[model samples]
Target chain A: MRTDLCDLLGIDHPIVGFSPSEHVVAAISRAGGLGVLGAVRFNDAAELDTVLTWLDRETGGRPYGVDVVMPSTVPTEGLPEDLNAMVPSGHHEFVERTLLRLGVPPLSAAQDRPGVLGWLHSVARAHVEVALNHPIRLIANALGPPPPDVISQAHDRGVLVAALAGRADHARSHVRSGVDIVVAQGYEAGGHTGEIAGMVLVPEVVDAVHVPVLAAGGIGSGRQIAAALALGARGVWMGSLWLGTTEYQSGHALREALLRATSSDTVRSRIYSGKPARLLRNRWTDAWSAQGAPAVLPMPLQNLLVSAAHDRLMASGDPTVVPMPVGQIVGRMNEVRPVAAVLSDLVTEADETLGRLHKLL
Target chain B: MRTDLCDLLGIDHPIVGFSPSEHVVAAISRAGGLGVLGAVRFNDAAELDTVLTWLDRETGGRPYGVDVVMPSTVPTEGLPEDLNAMVPSGHHEFVERTLLRLGVPPLSAAQDRPGVLGWLHSVARAHVEVALNHPIRLIANALGPPPPDVISQAHDRGVLVAALAGRADHARSHVRSGVDIVVAQGYEAGGHTGEIAGMVLVPEVVDAVHVPVLAAGGIGSGRQIAAALALGARGVWMGSLWLGTTEYQSGHALREALLRATSSDTVRSRIYSGKPARLLRNRWTDAWSAQGAPAVLPMPLQNLLVSAAHDRLMASGDPTVVPMPVGQIVGRMNEVRPVAAVLSDLVTEADETLGRLHKLL
Candidate 1:
């Protein structure tokens, strides 16, 4: 379990768990592998601060980190020349209407609830700054290379900067931009993914960059982790498996749905986030997939329209419309267990699989 | 379009277009790179005779190859293992019950419809024998590495041997066994696939083996081809795009499915062959995925039951149950044109994408 990543992070294993809940983050960190608290979902800075404080108190000085989204292309950055107005209004309307139709009665009441607006850039930056003030060991940027200033700032705080890359070229960008780590997320991953899936993506990124490559995408078990390490990834960064654990923060319905799911139960659909994110497929994703429905709206905008409604739908036990972001590996997550138990299982299974593999070699 | 793969394949481009139909194979072969004809569906002696004759006549003596499904781990030795009894009767009953329950009308009134029983190995051997009998240049094995005797036989004929590997270790085994080429089939690929996706699989295989590697997965457009080549692949093998071409013997329903598909529409399901193969998800796949249905039987058994129903379902003009095998890139297969045009576009796109990518480098 002790590898290059363990040496760098002062942890027992190279298993870096990514999750939205701070409690799970702290729990996993205490267990050994660093737990990275994802910041894309939170609306208020105070909530993040509260979560961080709780994590700090619970971990008893164990190392933990924070992650945020830094997309390579954005509507605000003006990269593709004409991407902002490029998306049709019908698409936006369709997304909004679908969320409206899927939401519970209380969702309409919370329709005007504060959303993750201006979060991609501004809020993400603010959270990073807040994270820097704390005893954070690492700061990771998802979707692309981190902004230049964020890299320098994290470096100034003795915090290592990590970035998620979908391609080898992106991994090269991370290395060139002074990233301490490159998290290679393949398409089998639960969140926003690109065309390149993990089996090819991981090693390509490993070869493309000089920095340590942490394998991400559909990695849930010890054997998978072993395969990643064997493929030359220094560590494994996972998200989907964390959702099914007892430590995960989830509504009754979403938890039930996740528990019921298998690997075949998910799909990489754009209906939820406008990006091709892997999520548990249900009647909602099915409806949009049919004819006559408008396309999904792009980022923050789609999230903006669906967030509160999503919250209400989950609370109302309406899984027909509520999307649960989980990777294809979710199929193996058939039971609820503690973070420590899951971590132990992964290490043990990986040891067994690696031992067997070594025999073959 | 020039790459390490082009250098290895001895072509102007690294693209290797795959088609079950030989006409498309010849068209791709004459265009520049190799064209591989799939032989899994090609029954024994006579059926292969017709197809190979068509390919040899059309290609005008140009170099082409045949792809076979040779599983190294099959439960056979001197004589091929008959997997009929190995497939649990429970699984077959499940299939029969499913068809009966779904009310899918039979494709033919004929009893004991032609199945994978008593044939695959002989068909595969016959295909190899016929291919060797032809003026072909290469032979590829899909399910696993080709048997040592087959490899030796193929090499003795001066026809190069290639094996599809889903992992670096698999590629390493092929290399150790003296395979000339290793096709890295990523999870993004259609048909029987390895657990690992292509992006990660490519470099791992490339780095692990001494032999040349061909990237196979969700590759379609030239950009994806360029990415594969850039990731240390010496060639790229494409499959899904061929189904939409003029030379393909596609039924009207299957062709419409491919034309209507987008990059977002496909998924990898084992519903067809009792193995995870990418295809357009439909009602049949959905039904099996629902609640507690018997798990899909492995390989030929699943193919036997599903193939019979598939024949009927496709003829019935309802794609909901007749979804055929394809890749994740089927979503990008939005038109039907000459296979040569598609192959050309892929090469052209690869060239443009490579140029842009080099700028970043």
Candidate 2:
């Protein structure tokens, strides 16, 4: 199941595991696939620097990457309190009403106030700076192409730059911006996504861009990975499949909720982070979509308005009320397994699938 | 490349070309793939019978099939005028306003009144009966499992019964209802579809069903066909790819519009039919979704109310006003070609893709 992406990314296999947990990222790197830690939740530059420093020693020097969320057009930046003030009171009221309706309790005084200033350009730039300081082999931008300076900085350090694109044109633009790889993330992906599905987008992006492309979205099994490679992707970028891994830092109840979910259990809604993201259909999403609910504010404001409520819901340990971003592949994640076991099973099944397909021709 | 489905369906290749045009159907069959002619557009039994007879001679003894749209629960059957009377006046007014806003002229007196009586259970039953009288090898129900009696009737005549499913449970239900094949149609499909995308739906359906599974939705190229087979589908069922074929009975301007469209130009909306359907985003779909527009009616009534306006829009020869049911694959339909050429190209490319993946193992 080896492809050029394996050599390009300095990984044993052409699989890239994306997770927000530093533990999962280190585990994936140790398991032969490249582990990419999502740095969007790291609001403070020092916090990200501390984590990357930990990750540098955790994987025993295996290749790993950091993913930052930076939109093409820079967004407004401010302190958490200032961003909260900008959110419309009606939207805030709706969130409050929804939390109450969902039976989520208020956070305790000991808990820190939740913030989403990471969505701001300043924070993302800081994340990139922190990531570059570590021994990272790759740097990825989740929303769009990283700024030109970031790309140049990564290249100067001999690190590969990758970006997630939902359309062929987006992939082309990323290539034009000097991205080394394009991850064609489709509509069925966990977080923010576009309308095109991976079955259509992967090949289109492959055809559009000159660089290698990794297929993402609705990819849980080895057969789907084989299918993605068959569609001309150099490898597969999988995120949602890692959520149920033992190393992922999610609540046990939320993990149980994800395990019980079917493919149809997810819906693409803007209630999560004020951008269209595929989330588990729960009270949080349903309440915001009700008839009287106010329109979700955009980006940083929406996340700032709902972050505290999200924290409370998670702290409540009520799976149905907790907001979870997941892909349609949630149906296939029926159990929690160690990262090494999951990667081993995926490689074994992918090789078997590829062998089976070879017989067809 | 052959699978067990080729032997079961008695086709040279594991591709099923789905189209309403009998001409395209015969060409696909003659080109060594199974062609399933859509009977939902045939309002008269005699008209369908005539087309089946023509297809019988046109294919020169090649295997072909018929596709009918029958809701799981039968709807009220009535004459065109009777059904039109059942439509709510508000919906009727919306359609009228939409046509006017799009500058679509009324159909001439010489043109026949458009009726969607074919959507009725009685008409669909008639289509099945007429198709049984021909040499069709398969019968596919597009909406849900054909009623138990319909399945039995097809089985009694040695005709295979197939059903389209968007979820694994639906596929299991179809298998329980005695379907010989299941077409796992995804959200990116051209016509009425469910929320699951093909990349996730195909393998899930394949695992759930005991019978052969054919992958559908966002399937335009040979590479997509290879991807489908790699995902464990026995074959591929493609509909949108035929829209630009030379044999398809569509206006040149409409074809041009499709050629000019990218994958992003289509939207899944219920404005086309009572059920959710993916259609080309144009003035027609936009007007129906604009603020103050009445809610789209369900099923037969919705089609009845919009039938006249649809006819008028088609007659206007304006690409933006014509409602075309197409998938995201519209981006790849840049030119008109013969069905044989399309099939040949798909086969050639699929074999090439499969061969490439084989080396990876």
* Best-matching candidate per lDDT: 2
Which prediction has the highest DockQ against the true structure?
2
Write one digit per residue (lDDT tens) for candidate 2, span A202-310.
Answer: 9899999889999999999899999999999999999999999988878877987898899999999987777789999887788877799888888878788888787
- Model 1 chain A scores worst on lDDT over the 10 consecutive residues at A75-84
RMSD of each: 14.5, 1.0
Question: In order, what lDDT does every prediction score?
Answer: 0.73, 0.90
Candidates 1 onward: DockQ, in order: 0.07, 0.90
**Alpha-carbon deviation at A234 in model 1, angstroms:** 0.5
Query: Best by TM-score, which number?
Result: 2
**Prediction 1 TM-score vs. true:** 0.57
Which residue ranges in model 1 land beyond 4 Å of their true spot?
A: A77-103, A108-112, B1-186, B190-361
Task: Tell me how far the alpha carbon of residue A198 in candidate 1 is from the true structure, in angstroms, after superposition.
Answer: 1.1
Candidate 2: segments with Cα more than 4 A from true spot: none
What TM-score, computed on C-alpha atoms, does each candidate reach? 0.57, 0.99
Please give, for residues A1-361, the per-residue lDDT of candidate 1 as tens digits.
4567888988888899999887789889988889999998766777788888888899889899999876656545332224335657776576567666765456455444654543356677778878888899999887676788889988998999888887777688778889999998888788777766765566567767788999898787665776566456788999988887889867767877877765556777876666778888887777678788876777755665556556656666765656677787766677888898998888887666445433221
